[model samples]
Target: MQSLSNRLQTQPDASTATALLQLQAQVDGDPSPAPSSDLDGMSLGGLKRKRCRGDFEVCALGGEVGRDVVERGLVTGEEAALYFGTFFQGCDKYVPVFDPSYDTFDSIRRRSSMLFDTIITIGCRAENGAVSSQYQALSNTTKSPIAEVLLGTTLPSIETIQALLINACYSEKGWMLTSMAVRMALDLELPDAYTQLCEIMLQGSDNVERERDLFRKARVWFGTFVLEHILSLDCGKRPGVRADGVAMRRCRVLLGSSARTTLDFRLLAQVEVCELLSSGDAGADVLLALAHDRLSPRVGVALSDRELGEIVQGTRIDLSIWLSDWITLVETAGATEEEKASLVVNLKIQRDWSEMTMLCKGLQGIGIDNVAIMSEEQRNLIRLAKISAQRHMSTIMSNTGLYLGGFRYGMDFVWAKCAFSVLLLLKLTRLLPESSNMPQLIADSKVLLAELSKVRGLNNIYFRILSLSVEKCERALKEDLAQAANPQNSGTQLNFPDAEMEFQSYVPKEFILEWSFPGLTFCWIPFDFQDLLMDFGSGL
Candidate 1:
């Protein structure tokens, strides 16, 4: 029989669940855990059992979990539901009290609704911890007791189980969750479903930002939790992992030493991109860590200004090389332009988080500054994100193809017009010849422009860029560029339409500009476009 302590040692996921259950079945009294249904034992399952090697690998988290318990005859209708019901509001006392005949997500959620009702009665105080210690306590108990129930083995200490779960809930991102951090911790697996009772307890949380952040955090934790659940499915002693160290060490995988080197930044090209679009910092932080550590060859995180400077010096800026790598990464899913756009946008946001912090500190220390100078490097990051988005768009559009995913050339392609102005803004920002020799940025922007201007370079829409640059120069650039003392506060974009007479100097036609900013859609008049709005607002 496998010891409870041994099962907690691996990276848990769906694959590991089967192993965990086999141990549970070996106990003399575990009356098969499977439940019967109207279809006479015909249940469509995600994973198929192979060789029926273990005793009981059941978990309430889905996949192999619901299976082994039913086959082993350990739970029945009311007993199973009552047993799994505790995770919900009023249901917490229910699941532990009665075993359920069958396992279903809908049933689990209902149990949660009961729990929800209870929380409401006590002023909903139980909802305070996003990641609760209460849930963690439940999880630690379940993974181990499960071993005892099936394998007839001695149980693990309560403290050891608690520590394993606490670490599991410790999200890779440094989101200082509320003490004992319950919200994130709730992702842990036990033997039942409690979602419904929980949802009722959580009312009116429909905020956009909140939902987005919540989803992101869920993805990361769910991935981690599932992996652990699967690993615990192992059948033998010290089952999941040979040791727990393997899983723990994987969490803090390091980036190379070059991550600490200073970047000249002059050799680096730049782009300004939107901040990550997640609802909260927790999810964004996790995504950022993934991008920094997993996506790039040289990963960095939370570097100080000096460290950032060292990184810039150590790294080489070869746009073709870097873009190739980035584009390839973005194209992996073969997703549509819209989907690709969303993912790319996320990728940019993560990159910005990883790189912008230290860049901001470095620029704030410029010699002649009375006020904090907005880091050009940060601006470059934003610019980089925009161009990066534009560059992959065609490849994205190409891969999804026009027929399958609503790929019409008119309205669908109209979004391209908006993207053009964004890229132009980045190019002009890079072209600004400030005292700092950021020629690399300018050169990089030019390369990006070559890609964007595929429409014979005719996308001249805005007046400011033409007004700013005297002439386009590559090496020994002569145009003087002024740095914004507080670029963060500057307006990089204005609602400038081609027809507005008030802004007649900016357009070829004056009378056409009389309509409202929102009414520009129907303005059918056409005119020669030039420098276009040279830059999209700011970088990161």
Candidate 2:
């Protein structure tokens, strides 16, 4: 049998749990010296597990953490409640998964130990070392003991899955944790008719029983599906859940809500995005024939300009229809001010992304060398891209809190939109050097990026890279423009036949590859561009 330690090592989402266990060992002054030999091939199951006698630390501030435990961590019940409210409330709004009315404190403590541990860990990290030096210390630790718990306990229950997801939402390493939760959820095989039948039979009232059990489970499963899909989409990976399986029409009936809520609309919008990006329908492929060829040079022959224009038009119409449906639903849903503002901004960001994708496709179809003398269709595509880029930046500025908090609350796609928008500006500057607004756009993006960097302990690596990449792109543009202004002072002779190709090559290929971002290596989507620019450093 696999040892507990080995099992914990295998689980991706167990980082926080594993770290806590290690900390507990250190705090208790574990006398068990480090291992003498590398037990690479040996199993550790035979070793006796250490049992700490101290009372467990309750993360909530100003709440009872039991009277007995020594070395109490800084968290009080009040603070823990706040973290839960901020990170999990968005989903709970629609699904009613964390309903306090139904979930008593004792019930949660007994049933959701894993969740309790996770919340405390997250609170420590978020505190930024203010409460104690250990908070900062725990924030740096990356180890997890997730496997031991999984092996030692019975198969995970739905309640356990719910806690794991809530924990994942607040975690810095969300994608890994969410991936593990997705697997466990699948293994649990939740929402089957047998469980619903049992609940109905037990309660003697189908409506009341279904409301408590069936609807609850359905909502939890939908939330899981939404997170799983969004994580996969943002990282450019194939989603683990089936899109058709979580259809909104069926979910609404299962939820039993009088009208669809904001959370439901958000989930539906995400599902649509997943479909839009990953759909393999023949019609979409035919529409994007040129883009398909540009993405993969092996196809050799590319589609004509007319064909590319037709594809862009088709994509626009599809996006329009998708937006209209969601807009109507959101307007009807009685959402709070914060929810309304965030949801509307999210939709706008998605629209901008869709517009950027289509326009870039059109630009690629025309061949970069000919952009200086563009056709009406090509110019329109460029114009649309610029407008969308500006709109995305402005939207983010207006709703700064939403996108910044997005890093912590499972709204990573919002940040991904911001990163992609910066790239769009880089592309525009490189292709349309003469456009007066490009310089102002680049400067505005830098200002916004600097503000994002101010976020305490931000975990998104790609977002950080935006600052460096933008600076490099701007420097390259300056050099190219200087050479153009004074050809006599150029340091080196240009060997390339076309100046446009030379200017295009200045940006590095490393930044363009989707896998350049962490945790995206396994993604097979054609969206990952290997290199749009050759060398931004060289003179055009």
Candidate 3:
């Protein structure tokens, strides 16, 4: 088990020769102010004095010392072994700086694959400890370090790296360390390290599906790992948590499943915080944040003075960062347009949809109340802002749909299907509000599904798409009916008061259910203006 401890390296690379020289000076601080005089140390007698214990024991103390002596000899071995035993432990750490074969090797460099195979074959032979020592005599003594330092450091040349591809060569714990390494590399822009790690994962395993399993099924465990390592309260667009200053992993969890046991086609989302609270799951909160962030930029017209009074206000958890994460996640989801459309439709039905709808309503309540005190001009600006926000949100919603619809990342996720349904539903609630042109929007959205149906394994997606569209159409009419029947006591125009009188009679639950999703119409709506997007944007 690789602990997060692997993320830290106390001896960060010394970038320049001066830095390296400074470090060497620090380590040799106690020895002497400068190299021992002896007139350039010419009288130092073959330099037997300075060596590490591992090297010293073999040369100094020629006899196999008793355990007691061995135990005693360990205190500052370099000092004790040389002074007490008249022998040395340390060897010069520097390997030779040149290799004779380098010139010839350059000609064979074009056959890099063959050269690598031969080198690995030699390494494998050295796997046995005895063979390793014997082989080290030949290669380390003759070629290896000198060759590498000369080729990599001394000359202006491409440094060749040895890498192999392995998929799912990682365990839940392994991924955490790997994730930290990846993040650190990304932050520092360490091209060499990042490339090295990506190569290791690619060569270590061939199971992409297993890799995804670690993504969804192990999120809780993964979250545990992340929380342990990543601890910073200053929330930002980029994850701020770090393991000893190394960036923590960014986790993506799938909450819903729509396919068979071995195949899970569902909503995949990047959730910032994975903890759960009575208020909601961190993942759920992330969706709410995404919705809000997506809506922030748009300025909408304000509500009438009377309507503004109804807006209830309270502080909400700030999720400005979540919106940015969502934006990137959704935008990168699908490789194509039709796939994107199917994803949008599927996302609309995700589990978070219903809850998100409610959450958005809460936001609307606060917003409306705040605007209630404003004049008509203020209300108009709010209205436009809301309208613009609704449009922008639709873009995110659409992009999310496209991504989820295209990727067939299999499902080993436990309880993911249910959770996904909830998110999709919540997302839909936020995306689809009562629109004046609900029928046209529904029609427009249908074309997206039709385009998506061409993709393989997406027939069911089209079916779900159809089901949700039918549901949206009926709810639009239902909303119209509800408003006409009991108009808001706050003065507003009534569309069909006569029809409203018989709304209960005109739109029975059973009749709507005959065509749309069960319980969909009444699921919930967050902000009334969301209806305007479905009604207007869809037709676009």
Candidate 4:
């Protein structure tokens, strides 16, 4: 099995290959490199002496101690390139500076140690751990002196993006940092190069050399576009670029031939997903799309039951097709076992989330007051919702220790998914059959949250909110169970106009399912459910 570095070292871009050869020659020409003392401001012995325990123990080991860690789930080339493309696109000059092969101390002559150190710090968080202590260790390592330096520096364009990506990668708990990263990327004028390429392409250039340069530029712009779109969706913020933006139009050029590989394909698919969300073609997840708008302008947009059902069904079909093609392409592209597993888990979670969203939309439309006297179809929706939540939880559990030595690619996002699944399960426990294993599911979710909390940091306010939400859920469940035991006691009327409001308020506001960034900043604003929440509050 070729290593991530090796795979990245062999990525198919002809220009990248030539540049690497040249970079290798330049490094080789300098026989006497900087002294170790001056290089990272640490002696070789001192560098080896600093170590990390807990979830990141393997990564912090010495030549002997870290040998197993390095051999096992090292960062993949694709991950490195993805991050690179995500933030450093259009600026080819900074490519080698942040390239993965230069990740080691041995390759630290030209590159910044801050960059190298940041990768290790974030990578450590994804390490598979058997206990919370491992996660604790991972969190603490981010506070290391070296990491502190990198975190605090105001690097230039390329390094700024590099630093921002690291910050976003490590600070996965909240949208604040991620949103900040998006904002910073825009401020640096990162996407401007791609815009220029678009102009050049349309100017009628038959020059093959210029065409290749244009292709590269278009890809870079697309890379930045992908980052902006995904982060925008995740943060519930408006995307910097619109669906009909120049970047999207130029990005499709890849579909002509440049997108045959898995990475490019994923990028293209993500672009489409972003466009769908932006264009409000989100199918069953239309509520989420409207929420991302931040204004809740579509709150009044009404679809009849049949129309909504058709939309949901259409979405499911589209996602099914995308998922199927994604799987086949990844397998056919010769991705490693680890890569395949990671991608599959992420995809399955996406599917489950979609199902849950559809279920939620249907439930909201029906209103809680109607749930007690729901039609067969409504009951069926509840069943599917429970199954979807369960599938999401099960998939998450199966992939819990995915970071062990493999790529810790999506742990932060996975944490968010786990939180979402747990909240859904808590809500479903109220509606599902009493014999359902909801109690056990809820217990497992709490444990998962506890573990994730340790990794996110003690100061992470989002996890604290999640913990409180879980408690509120448990309390609500107990109260309901007690009420169920005393059937003779009079409760609120089944057809009361206010029943839905009561139900919405029953689930703690914290568990309201906003994908805001990590940490405490009272500035978090939620919109998708906002209109519904406001309507209920206003007695509508």
Provide the overall lDDT of each model, using Cα atoms, as 2-decimal numbers.
Answer: 0.27, 0.49, 0.30, 0.46
Worst 10 residues of 3 by lDDT: 87-96
Q: Write the per-residue lDDT of candidate 1 for residues 515-540, one digit (tens) a residue.
A: 00111111112222212322323331
Give TM per candidate: 0.25, 0.62, 0.27, 0.54
TM-score: model 1 vs. ground truth:
0.25
Best-performing candidate as measured by lDDT: 2
- Sum up the clashes in candidate 4: 12
Runs in model 4 with CA error above 4 Å?
Answer: 1-156, 172-224, 245-269, 276-301, 358-384, 403-414, 432-436, 443-540
Q: Which stretches of candidate 1 lie over 4 Å from their true place?
A: 1-108, 114-308, 313-326, 362-540
Measured with C-alpha atoms, the lDDT of residue 5 in candidate 1 is 26
Best candidate (score: TM-score)? 2
Candidate 4 lDDT by residue in tens digits, 104-203: 3344313443344344434443443213454454344334432322332222234434544455544543334444444444444444544554455566
Cα shift from native, residue 64, model 4 (Å): 34
Tens-digit per-residue lDDT, 198-307, candidate 2: 34444556475455555455555556665655444344454554432222333323222522345655654654454444343211111232234333224466656676
TM-score, cand. 2: 0.62
Evaluated against the true structure, the overall lDDT of model 3 is 0.30
Query: In candidate 3, residue 470 scores what lDDT?
Result: 45
* CA RMSD, predictions in order: 22.4, 11.4, 23.0, 13.5
